[model samples]
Target: MHTFAPKSIASHWRLIAGLLPWLLTGCASAGYQMPDLSLDSLLGSDQAAARGQPVADIGVTRCDQLTTHEDDWDRVNGVPPVDGEDIDIAAAIPACEKALAEHPGHRRLQAELARAYAEAFRYDEAFRLSGQAAEAGSLYALIQQGHAYRYGRGTPKDIDKAVNAYQSAAKAGHIGAMNYLGSTLYQRDGWGDRSKAESWYRKSANTGNATGMANFAQLLLIDGKQEEAFPWFERAARQGNAFALQQIGTYYAVGGEPAIKAPYTALSYFEKAVEKGRPSASVKAAKLFIQEAGDTSSRLSESERQAKVLYWIEYGMPKLSTRQ
Candidate 1:
């Protein structure tokens, strides 16, 4: 083996200079975190199932084990659910089909297969199956129908229809549906109703919905009610909501009525948000490392600080496009 020469200081500086533009671009765009309209948010967890409400048997089939969304209301004991993006659509579609074939006329299986189809972008199949399940009184299926109409997956985009479906499910006391209704009303281009959105969010939050708590808290933060928002953010964070974790990090980074300035603690929360799939936190974490490096009173040596910065840049660069 041949001995290798270490990189020169100039080379290191040159590398950092090359990376600076990418880092700054990510940081600049990080200010506007888009509202989450992800699959998990759309197909939220089933509070009724968690409360021991009677639901169709979902654990008996291999399809259920493979395609069950992590937030799905019904889960089989000992079998973990996967995130929406984590679903293997090709495999899930076939598995669900086989299960439905075995248990003919099973509305729940239809809904599950519909979800798999939706994930695969086979919106026509998703719409058909979800419609069938909705007719059979599956609130989750109704929500899926709303999503299809709202986004025009396989049907014409109809906000009124979407709102109607969400309202029907919300009337049935679906916490996720309430949150969806709030999001829809709050973000509906020119006709958004802030008062109605706030009302729905408050309803969901009162029912202990983590997403609702986070959404309501965001509105409070926007209105400069940091002290009031902090508790709600903390509540959501305790339930492992990534957005709430990031918000808490922001509060900690800047001294405020409820949150004291704590850079190290803030950095930890940012890292946690990254772990929870909030890529925007990566830039925040990197910036904090750079700030710590520049502070002469900090305990880290110059070389150590440089290494940390490099590590963060490399770690966060690939994730910048997945900002949430």
Candidate 2:
């Protein structure tokens, strides 16, 4: 593991679909969409030993749920949990609350519910649920408490307290705690304490946290330490980290010493990344394909490059945007 900034790599959660995108929505109703795709096989499907049945169909309507008052679509804006994105605050909140009640005692479920409340700007409820969750003492639950305190979801702003909780969790073997703590320190922008930010990132990476490794690599690469960063990126990529794949693609595209900057190699990495189902990488790879192969008018070029962008936008973005 290496040291890097929190934002240096893509956010931890962004790797969900690629790392292991399984549904946690708990929507066991008649209309839920269940794509039967496994990310590992997704990229190699055409050449796969056998074509697996789709676990869920993205096109499923879930019609009644969409319009039902109980489904909570009213509050969601259809955006994802990615930072800098918007979500339907009001409807989503009630939906999550309803879910929590139905699946009580599931810490991940409660944490998500609390997070939804926090996302919707409902601090009181977020705090309440997070409190209950923290009492459960789950890693995700403790992280929720940290979220409540630092972001003032229910309590006043207190960086120190949030840091303490994160540190405690990090020490207690919560890998995500390392991410949270590292991110907080990195955001501090204490020029004199840049090392401190990197230190926390190392703690996170040492925890075998994929996000931490990705971020650490990102930090090193951005700082012109690609020599050191490549290993970290490889570490995360080995775990099916789409972001790391994209980074490797970039290295290949650029032709570094250890990594030959061959468009073919880059394409291989990008295509693999796209197959593993990283939307951004799909788009990036598509963009690169076009840039390298020229415009869509060429018959051969069009077939190869054009398909990349289509899937990236059509199938990729929607799935990513709708994900929690």
Candidate 3:
């Protein structure tokens, strides 16, 4: 799984943590009314596919006495070890703890449990478990440890330690680590080198990491190489990256290249991204709606345009504000 910044609500845990407060406050000063739907329903049913179903939903009734030998244990775990964004942190603790007790040395399980701990905001336990998993040779654990150190989650914020952890994991062939390391180097400001960052991103992309592809394309775009960047962005979007999806939609809407520009196609992509929990897509959708309405050649009416803008403002503002 790709690790997003703390400010971003892309991860299930971050979304839940951030949204819970705003959901209660109502932000009345902003003149925004809370929706009638439960906070859980705010994300909608598509979250199952977006986040992955949880262990309980996968028919594993007992988190205790878990089968560590199962092949599924080696795969990446969604929150609470299944495909949903709404994680019950309190409930997940015991099951994950019991599994670790039984399997004592299972690296993947340790890493997954570390992620569970991290999501629950139990950073000390998350860091400890990540270390244990890393010692057991789990590359995923190494990445988790890097994140913990990077943001000072459980320990001091040490960029050097974070870089070391990511380098170790990337060298061991962890794609997520590779991409993250690239990003860290890219965003390190004065100490960061774009050329170095771009190389690492390319290396990650070569390994078929979708996030890496998106990152590389973004760098290309920064260099004004839109024609070269287009295919890479499309590739990442096909891999279900919401950022890439929105970027491709923006490209299509703006007509950078005559061959690919199409407002309807752009609208479809923006809608797809919005369903995937991307707040920017809502604003983009609003802009495109108004733009299409204003086109003298289009059949859309003024009323429809206002309705679309109003809908997105009502819908997107809450999410965008929470992220900010």
Candidate 3 per-residue lDDT over residues 109-166, each given as its tens digit: 6766776677767889889887776665555566777799889998888776676677
Which of the numbered candidates is closest to the native, going by highest TM-score?
A: 1
Query: Model 3 TM-score?
Result: 0.70
Ranking by TM-score: 1, 3, 2
Stretch of 10 with least lDDT, candidate 3: 13-22
How high is the lDDT of residue 166 in model 2? 62
lDDT by residue (tens digit), candidate 2, 1-324: 322221222433331111121122221223323233232222233423221112212221222122212111112234233231344555555665666566565444455566666666667876777566554544445566676667766899766567655654554445566678777756644443345557667756765667789888887877889888888887787676777877888887777565765676676677667766676777666667667764322446556556656766565464444333
Clashes of each: 0, 14, 6
Clashing pairs in 1: none
Name every residue pair that clashes in candidate 3: 52-83, 52-84, 53-82, 53-83, 54-82, 54-83
User: Across residues 126-188, which tens digit of lDDT does each residue of candidate 1 receive?
Assistant: 999987766665667878888998999889998767866776666556777778988886776
* Candidate 3: residue 173 lDDT (0-100): 52
Better lDDT candidate (1, 2)? 1
Measured against the true structure, the TM-scores of the candidates, in listed sequence, are 0.77, 0.60, 0.70
In candidate 1, where is summed lDDT lowest over 10 consecutive residues?
11-20
